[model samples]
Target: MSRGLLRSTAVFSAMTLLSRIAGFARDTLQATLFGTGGAMSAFIVAYRIPNFLRRVFAEGSMSMAFVPVLNEIRERGDKAALKDFVDHMAGALCAVVLVVCGLGVLLAPAIASVFTPGWALDQPDKFAWTTQMLRITFPYLLFISMMSLAASVLNSFGKFALPAFTPVLHNLTLIAAMLWLAPQFDIRPFGLAWGVLIAGALQLVLLWPALGRLGLRPRLRAGFHHPEVRKVAKLMLPTLFSSSVAQVNLLVGTVFASLLVDGSQDWLYYSDRLIEFPLGLFGVAIGTVILPHLSRRHAATDAVGYSGALDWGLRLALLAGIPAALGLFLLAEPITATVYNYGKFEAFDSRMTAISLTLMSLGIPAFMLSKVLSPAFFARQDTKTPMRAALLTVAANVLLTIAFTTPLWLYKVEGAHGGIALATALAGIFNAWLLWRYLRRAGLLQPQPGWGRFSLQLFAACVVMATIVVGLRLWIGSWTEIAQPTHRIFWLFVVIGAGALSYAATLLASGLRPRDLRH
Candidate 1:
């Protein structure tokens, strides 16, 4: 990547790290306050419904489509047209999502029933809570989706940090709600749902001033039939699946998990959160920065810059993603036990969460690869190929979920939810492979030289890091057996820090350098 782009990515990643830290605090509070089984599972169901779709239309597909066109407009140097497009898109998205939110709120019970039919059948109380929370949280899709639009605009203009930092407010809001508000409710999970609602609106509000500073504050002129608007609409249709394949697979797991034991949903949800930490901190930052860079490169017809950016993103993603995956897989138990096993969240819950976390960690590389690869397609306005790949990936996910989870369910496996996670991981690998294959076949991605050396260095570092982490982890015995939560937390960080230092040292010794990442 160019030095400027690298700086932007770093800015975004640093801000994302703050947000992720805040997110850990929020998750810890939620686990301690709400635990896993009944109402937390209900909240997960309700939250995932809208949140998954938010990833689809907001950060995933919509930005993929919007950024390229927005870059095209900006490249034309027509400020009026640029502002017009932003305003119209703002109004159109708001109009559409408002209608969808209304429908979601109205259909809350039916939506809840569809996702958790088992709850409806046997656990009516959980079903009712799902519906209630869904009613409260559905509108989050509207607010957060708009916030993403604002963020996309900010990113296209090279203002990465504000957009990246906005998520911190979201985490803080939830933390506050859990700490102060949850205790007031007769049913505390209601506080979580309220937090979701408030966070969405607050995040959007938080970005408004940043938008104004850019002279791009949307005035909300509805223009669905406008040519640019129609083009974005056309693009969004295919990406509905293509952009959010992982989230789609997770929703599939959620549906299947509903039929399993009570806490299966929570187990899957918490494990997914753990895996998302690395992804959000790095994979997403790469994707977010690269999209606009690639879009501008495409608009300028800079093939060399485009390919270099793609190459750089792939190399960086692997350097961070592979080791992160291995580290998470190695430390799943300690990580889960330290982060979650508290208050009402028992050791069994932590153990179950670790099972899923370990399995899901396998998908991190594929997930990060797709993060970069999908944007390569989207940057060039080529959504169809990824859409086709996404279709097959999701189909494979469903089949694999059944194949993996069915036997676990039949045999009465203790952590049947882990099978759902394993299937998702495998499906993600398939999805990334498909995207990579598509990119290669199209002759759009030409790997820069030294890839073989890069691969070897990554492998060497991972092996070294894994050996050290495992050695220390074994020496420490078990995380759940630790007497104090603080002690467990302290040791987990020690192991993680040592592993990170070893990985970086090995990489440096193997001839990987900061300069190599720049060019």
Candidate 2:
């Protein structure tokens, strides 16, 4: 059982790594060509509003609600019922997204005003660009939402590869759009908005045929009044905020960031992207693979199996998240300067980006832990607990943002946006602790043996790894001074590779074995 779960996660992570590599290229090109200027900031805001909703309505809340119920119906051996439920779900999801997308297009200007009222007032051109791009990108919610439904069905059916690779195509499309399509448009950056719309439809189409292979092609049936449909909608409500706390907090940060400099939003967006690398590679892969497993274990009343899966997820989270956080925090400046300090992106922009990236790196372990913990509640169809956690976390984030950023904004301090990153990190840690305490109180998480030894091994490994990385950084000074970009990239790899190997060797030398991870 451990091997199966590990294999699935490995497969998913490998595919996601390719997508991340593609995304790296996309961002490198985007930063080089556009830089963190008024135009790119406009694109970031327009893209973010829809992307945030995609997480809320499509990937985050929607998947958590739909998967366990699908597992339940599958457990009961009810093919007809499953088909009926899926059809109604498709129609119902589409029906709602259509209206939402329509309203989004109609109110693009007002919506942009709300998120960035500062821009609307101070930079009217940026605001107009935001409204224009938003009108193009708003329909992406409908396409990506349907694609998520298809992905949920495929995941439950144990076909993980196709859905995992869809993002590869998504990124590739955007890269092509930037190179070829951007110049063709009147406003060159409008091509990025068009790229999003095209990519969403392409991904949905890519996943649709896979469902037919499983005999689960959903023929749309608007059974909004259907009991199962209503059940899913009800299950979806609390997760609306709970499953997407990070995104909600970032959106809040966007509001505050608008008051800073022109490219403040771009800096936050790029730094958050850096934070998501290990997160998408390991954290998301582990969470996605385990949720259905936990749901099935719960359906069978196999408490032992459920606990074991949670334990595995928790251990893996710490194993990957800690080293990732340390690496990002230690190398934030070099990494930023090497990748993005070309074309229009200047040293000033790199410095600003590194500030936020360093602060946000502190939240990696917490973000990963919450990813594992929230699924524990959702697997049992208990969404309200995480929702409560979500509410407090966001509230705390707002208060913290105000406390942290207001003083900086008041004083006209440089890099004021880092305060937003700091608040987001602190709130994430608070949320993870709350969920951990809730799970203990509810008696859902029974810690397996060796937690003490396991934690110690991780601590020792990280300490060794950090020492090596810092020494290397101090020896190889002045990353941005290298005339050749390839030289900088090569040295950066050398540093990362050494740290990774040092970490693994320390673990093995400390008596940690591969078999320990499996069982």
Candidate 3:
């Protein structure tokens, strides 16, 4: 089981790394074409609305509800029953998502107003532009939700690679749009919106053959009365909030950010893109790969296996997340300047974005740990506990966003967006704590032996990596000051390579081994 878990995690992480690279390219083009300006801020708000719902339903809520149930059916080895349940879920999800998409399009203006009240009041044109872009992007919800359902089914059957690779398609599509399509459009960002809509259909289409190859192709028939359908629906209710709490927190941050300054939303958005690299590459991949194993352990009533899986997940999260957070924090400025300082994304924009990225990087462990911890509850079919934790998280986020940002905005602090990022980081810590407390109290998990030594070794490695990165940064100076992209790229890779090598050497000297990851 441990070997299989490690293999699956490697597969998912490799595919996710490809997707993140493509995502970075897409973002770089986006920054070059449309910098941190009023239009970009509006586009961020517009894009985030549908993207939030995508996370809420497809990535977060539905998958958490669907995967465990499907795992159970697969474990029973009842192929026909599994197919029936999948078809019913397809019908139900399709019916519901279609209606939601329609409403989203029709209500685009109203939704934009609610999400970006300050923009609406202060800059009606930007607000209007957001509504237009949002309408075009809304239908992405319907198609991508179906794709997510398909991906979840594939994941249950141990077919992880195809689904994990699907985002590469989306990123490539957006990059193409930025390069060619955006230039043709009157409003260039609208090309990005169109790209989103087109990519959604393409992703769903790509999944069809994969599902058919597995003999799990979903047939469309209303299964509103199906027992499994009802179970998923019941689970999805609480899992909605619980699984998507981070996105909800980001959305809440969007609300606060809209009122801050002209480019505040764009600054926050760029920082978020940088932070998502580590989160997507390792944090989310770990969560995705662990869910099915955890579910199997829970279904078989193997408490020891379940506890072991959770422990393994937590350990990996720390191992991957600690160095990543430290590296990002230490190299925030260079990364932002190299990746995004172009066209209108000037030196000041890079500096502002780095501030937020630095603060958010401080929460990487908290964020990644929460990813693994929440699934521990979901795999047990216990959504209510996570739902409660999610509520506390959101509340803390809202209150802290207000608490931290108010004084900054009141005192006219430049880059108040950094305060919002700090609030989010703090809230993530609180959320992770609550999740660990509840899980420990319920006896769902217990820390395995060697955790103390493991933690010390990981922390020591991170400290080494941070020292190396900071020293390299001081020696190389600002990426923004570099005249040529080739020079910037070369030095950036060098810094990253030096930091990675030092960290690996530290781990080796501390007696960490490759096989230890399997344990």
Candidate 4:
């Protein structure tokens, strides 16, 4: 970790913190307005349809393929060539995304039926609502995909903070819409869906001035025939399949959960939102900064630089992610109760969400590790490897979901939410393992002497943090009742703050310092 890397990480982490805070506010509004019910389930289903595509075509494959190539051209060619590449890719992406989104709108019913059959069978009205919402929000995928491309350009140029902070605006827009517009529309969740569109537009608009500042004026042009455009298209095909497989796993979980009970899908969605807060803040922000840096190092054939970058990323992820995971696991009930026990949400709902949160916390490291390791392959232009790993993970997810859910369904378990959580955890571990193995086999990760010391320190810190969190929870167990949201809220902060202090003190005692991060 050089000073430059540490500085970049700090900026990214700060932006991610803001984004996560706004995201929490957005989730709070949604939970209060719809609770864990059909409306919320429908909204999750509808929103996920476009979101899946956005990740696949926009942020996932496109960024993976486009950024490195852009960096290469910018390194070797002149400014005019880089500008030409951006304009061509932008036009090509728009045409492709528009056609795909239009098809998604036309086939919403069929798509929704396949992904969420239980909604179609048991709640036809909800199914129709989801279809309509999907139509309204699907175009957002197009705009945001373009936005992601623009952000990738800015990021590769070492201009990261603005693009990284863009999600804060997205979340703020949704929060405002939920607060102000939901009441005006008698349709409840429709306003939230409208907010999704507005947020996507805002995200795009917010990036343009930044692009101008970078001296790149992207225009819609017929650059589809450019050789570089074709090269990107060639890489994108397998990458798209890989991205779709990951999204399909989520749809599978949603469909399976929907079949189990009325609110199962919503419960899982809310719990996922909680886990995503840290995932976005730490895993995604780190991954965003690491990729371009790794790409440049790999291009320069600096194996030591690449390995050091990966090491620092993994270390920082463990530093923040481990304590957060432990805290979430220990205070799941209190945290859920505090954040979501309002309006239509009730005590039992909090318990269910807490169970899901605990399970998700167990998988947080796997999720973060996958984010850190996958960049190695992406930097090397090997999307197919991750695609293979993703396929295996999805298959494992389906198998584990069936195995866990069937036994619970037969035995009449009191809380089947745990089974979904366990299945997802297992799947995530499998995904992370495969990613690590592939990266090692490809000669991406070199053995470093300090890695063992770093791992030991991280494990020790996690243990100390978990012990403190559990001890504090036991000490305050009587005060934090799931039925009393206010009490739970009070204890939630106390327990978390105490645990965080304990972890930080332990890390400092273990000889880890801010200066140690500077390689």
- Which of the numbered candidates is closest to the native, going by highest lDDT? 2
Model 4 RMSD in angstroms: 1.8
Per-model TM-score, in order, reads 0.99, 0.99, 0.99, 0.96
Q: For model 2, what is the alpha-carbon lDDT of residue 120? A: 86
Candidate 1's displacement at residue 456, Å, is 1.1
Candidate 3 lDDT tens digits, 152-221: 8888778889999999999999998888888898878888888999999999999877899888899988
Which pairs of residues collide in model 3?
none
**Ranking according to lDDT, highest score first:** 2, 1, 3, 4
Residue ranges of candidate 4 with Cα displaced over 4 Å: 241-246, 410-412, 478-487
Runs in model 2 with CA error above 4 Å? none
* Tens digits of lDDT, candidate 1, 336-422: 999998998999999999999999999999999999999999999988999999999999999999999999999998999989999
> What C-alpha lDDT does candidate 1 achieve relative to the native structure?
0.92
Worst 10-residue lDDT window, candidate 2: 181-190
C-alpha local distance difference test of each model: 0.92, 0.93, 0.90, 0.81
Against the true structure, candidate 3 has what lDDT? 0.90
Residue 328 miss distance in model 1 (angstroms): 0.8
